[model samples]
Target: MLPLLVVSALAAVQSLAYEQTLGFNSAPIVETRSLDEIYHAALAEGGVVTFWLGGDEKGDEDAIKKEFEGKFPGMTLNLTTDLSKYHNGRFDEQLAAGHVYVDSIAFQTVHDFPRWEEQGALLHYAPVGFDKIYPPMRDVRAAYYGILTVGWAGKWNTDKLPGIAAPIEWEDWLRPEFKDKLVLTYPNDDDAVLYAFDLIMQQYGKSWFERLLKQNPRWVRGTRTPDTVMQASNSSWAASFTSDGLFPTSNINVSHPVQGSFVTWFQLAAIPKDAPHPEGAKLLHNFMLTKEWQATRGSWPVRSDVEPPTGYPAIFEMPGTNITYFREWMSDRAKLERLRTWFEDKLGSAQGLSPLIDGI
Candidate 1:
C-alpha cells in the first residue's frame, strides 16, 4: 500500500486535473479573441449554430435569428423557443439518443444547468464579457452565466385605483381598502411567484398571507393574465406581474417592492459539450454579451458596464432585491412539492396555465 501522504497528494492532483479540464476558472477555455476572429473561425467550421431558448413565442426566436444574421453576415442562426420544462425534456431525449442537436441553450431551468455541468454535457466557454459579468450571476465553475435578470413586482392600474397611492412594499398590498380589487397569480403556478411568496412569508409571517386571502382577491393562472387584467381595468392591482418596463402609455404601472423583490430567475446560457458547431456557439455567445445586443434585448444585462434601460436600476442597485441562489429549493423535490401542496390548500387549486412561456 502507498503511504497515506502520497495517496492524499495523488487524490488532490486528480481533483485539480478534473477541474482544470472543465475550465472552472473564469478564464474561458476558448482563447481570448475578438468577435471578428471568432466569427471567421466559425465560418471555417460550417457557420451554423442552433439555440433552444425558454419561451413559447416565435417572435423572440425570429428576432434573435434576424439580428444575429444581420450582425454577422453569411452565418445562420436557428433558434427554437419553448417552455424551459419542454426544452429540458428535449435535451434529455437528445442526450439519451446520443445525438445532441443544439449548439447552445438559454433557459429559466437554472437548477438543471448544474446537473448538466456535472454530467459533462455543458461546455465551459466564457464569452468575451464573462469577466465583466456580476460575480453572483456567473457560475463559480464557469460552466454557465446568467445572461439576463427578470423581475416580478407589484403592478397597479392608475385608472382603476384613481386617487389611492400605489403600494411601495409587499405589506402595503395587505391594506384593507385594496382588498377584493387585487388579482394574484397562484403562488404554486410559477417558481418566480413561488419565490416571491416565500420571501413574503419569510418577511411578514404566514398570518399575512392568511389575512390577504380573507380579502377574497381574484387568483389567476399565468403571469400575463394579471397584467392583462390590470391593463383592461378589470383589476385595480396585481401582486405578481412581470415588469417589462414597456407599458409607458398604458395605465398599468409597476412598483418595485421596497422590502426587496425576488428575482424570478436569471436566464442562464451555456454551450453544450457535444455541440456540432462550437466555434459558432462561441461566436454567438460573445456577440450576445456585447453592449449593443444586451441593451436591445430589454432584460437586465449581467455585464457591469451595460446600463439598464431608462427608469430601471441595475440588479445590484435594486433595494431589498433577494437574488439568493435557489439551487437548494430546486434540488429538494419533496420539500418543493410539499410547499406547493401547502399553498394550494390555502390559496386553492392553480388554474392549469401552460408552462410553454417563461415556465411561470
Candidate 2:
C-alpha cells in the first residue's frame, strides 16, 4: 500500500475546520476603491511598493515591473523573485524581527497564508475584483486570493524524437529509447513538481519509481529547467511535469495525459498587515486582478470573466487534472516533506544550478 499513513491527513480548504477555524477571523474587509483612486493613494504614500514574488529566476521580475509601472505612472515597484520555500522563511524571519519590509507576496506556499492570517499578520483588505474571483480561489476572509493558476504537464521535443507519439503518457517516457533522455525538476525543490510526482506514484506505486531510477533521468532545481533543456534539444523527454505550455510554432509539446492526473495550483498573493507602504500594496493587489493583467498571464485567471489562454479550456474545466487535491496536498507540509525526502532517497540529491543561474 502507498503510505496511507502519510497521505491520510489530507484536508480541503473548504472543510469546516478551515472555514470555521478558532482564533482566525473569516470575515472579509472588502475594498471599495477604483484602481485610479488606489493608485493616487499609493502615490501619496511614497509611491513605492515592494513584493517578495516567488519564482526561480530574477529575470521574472522584469515584465511585472514594466506592466505595473506603465499602468500607474510615478509609482515604483521593488519586486524580488526567489523560491517560495526561501521567501516564506524570510517572511517569517522579518515578522519575528518586528519589521516587515515587503509590501506584498505572491507565493506557492499555500499553507503559509492561513498561518499568517491566524497570527494576525496579513492585511484583511480585499482587492477590487475580489467578488468576481472564483469563490474557491479566494480566501473566505479575503486576506489572500489566487492571482494566477498554473499547471504542470509532461513535455517532449518532437524534433528530437521524430516518430514520438503525441500527448505522450507519463509511462511512455520509461521506454528503452528514452533512457538518459529525460530531464526533471527535483520534487524536493518545488512543491508543484513534488505534487506531480506524488500523483504519479499514487497511481503506479514504488515499482514505477524503481524503474524510473533505473532510467537515470537528469535532475535539476526549478520547474523551468526541464522545459528549457528540451527546448534547447539537450533532452528529448521529461517524465516529470513542466509548467510551460504548447505554442503554435514550437516543436515542444505539453502532454495532457488521458491515463493519469496532471497537477495545477493557484499562485496565492496577499498584503502584509505591517507593509511599509500599505496603499501601494493594495494598489498592486488590485492591479493584478485587472483585465489587462489577467488576460496576459498565459495561464488560467482566477477571475471568471477573463478568457483563458488560446486553445485551452479553464484549468478547472480540463479533464484528467486535479486542482482541489493539489491544494489539499500543499496544505499538509509534513506529508510533502516526507514525500520529498522519499523521492530524494530514490533519485539521489538534485544536481545543477537553478534555472535562474543557468540562464533559462
Candidate 3:
C-alpha cells in the first residue's frame, strides 16, 4: 500500500482530472464572449488596465499600447516595461502587502509563472485561442500560457564580413579572423543568455568557455546591444547568441548552428487573481491572442493556427529547437545561481546602466 500522504495526493490529482472532464475546471476553456463583448464588459467595469511587460527596452510596449488602445477606444492601457527580474520582485512585494496594482504580466522568466500559480496569485482564465495554442505552451489548468516565442541565434553583419558564410556552427566565431570583432552579452546579466551559454558549455565543456573568453569579445550589458553595435558596423558578429527578425533588406543575418545547441522560450503571460480591473484584464488578454495582434507580432505566436512571418518556419517545426530546456533550467534555482555566480566571478560584474534606461 502507498503511504497515506502519497495516496491522498494521488486522489487529489484524480479528482482534478475528473473535474476537468466534467467541465467543472473549464471556465476559461468554455468562455464564449467575443472580443467586442469583452471590451464592452471592460468598459462597464471601469475602462482601465495596467500591464507589466518584462524586457530590456522601455519602448518595447509602444506598438502593443498603440494597437490595443486603437482597437478599443475609450480604454486606457497603462503598460510598463522593465526587466523581468525586477518585475517579479516588485510583484512579490505587492502580493505580500495585499496591494496588487498591475492587472497582468508577460515575462521572459518562465519559472516565475508556476510560482505565482502555486501561490494563487494568478487568474486561471484562458484566452480565446487557448485550445489553438501548442500543447506544451499552455497550462492544463488554464493558469497561464505562452504569448509568443523569443529565440537567440548567431547574428552577423553582411557588409562588414563580406564573403564569410553565415556562422551556423558554434566554433565558427572562435576563428582567428573573428578575434576582437565579436559583441557578447554577459550571461550573468540575463538568464536566457545564460541558458544559451549553458547549452554551449554542456556540448563543448568549460575549456570552450575559456577559449571564448580568450577571443576577447567586446562585452555588452543587454542582448539588444550586440545587434545595435553590429548595425553600425562596430562589430562583425554577435558572440554566440542574439535575437532579431527576418527581413530581406536587413544587413544582419540570424542563424543557428546546424549541429549544436541553441535557446528559445515562450514569453508567458497571466492575469493577477486580485487585478483591479479584472474585466479589462480579460479583454486585453483575449485581444492579444486574436488574429489581428498575433499576425503583427515580430516573434512567432504561441497559436498553432497562426502562420509564422515570411522567411521563418514555426518554432516547433524548426529542427534543433526545444522550448522546455530553458524552462527546466530556470526552475532549478540552486544550479542556476551557482553557474551564474561562477560566470560573474570570472567576468567580474556586468557594467553600465540597463539598456532600457540608458537608451543604448
Using lDDT as the measure, name the better of candidate 2 and candidate 3.
3
Query: Which 10-residue window in model 2 sums to the lowest lDDT?
Result: 9-18
Pick the lDDT winner. Answer: 3
* Model 3 bad stretches (over 4 Å): 1-29, 233-240, 244-249
Poorest 10 consecutive residues by lDDT, candidate 3: 13-22
TM-score of each: 0.81, 0.88, 0.89
Candidate 3 lDDT over residue span 46-95, tens digit each: 89999999888888678889988999999999999999989999887677
lDDT of 2 by residue, 157-178 (tens): 6677667666456777688866
| lDDT of each residue in 1-360, candidate 1, tens digit only | 999866765654343324334444444484489999999999999989998898634453578888899999989998888767678999876665556789999987788887777666777777888888888778865789987666666677777666677777777877776777787777786665676677778888999888888878887765566666666534455333443343344566666766645544568899987899999999888988888888876567778899876777776676767454564466666777788888988777876546344343
Single out the weakest 10-residue window by summed lDDT for candidate 1: 238-247
lDDT of candidate 2 vs native? 0.78
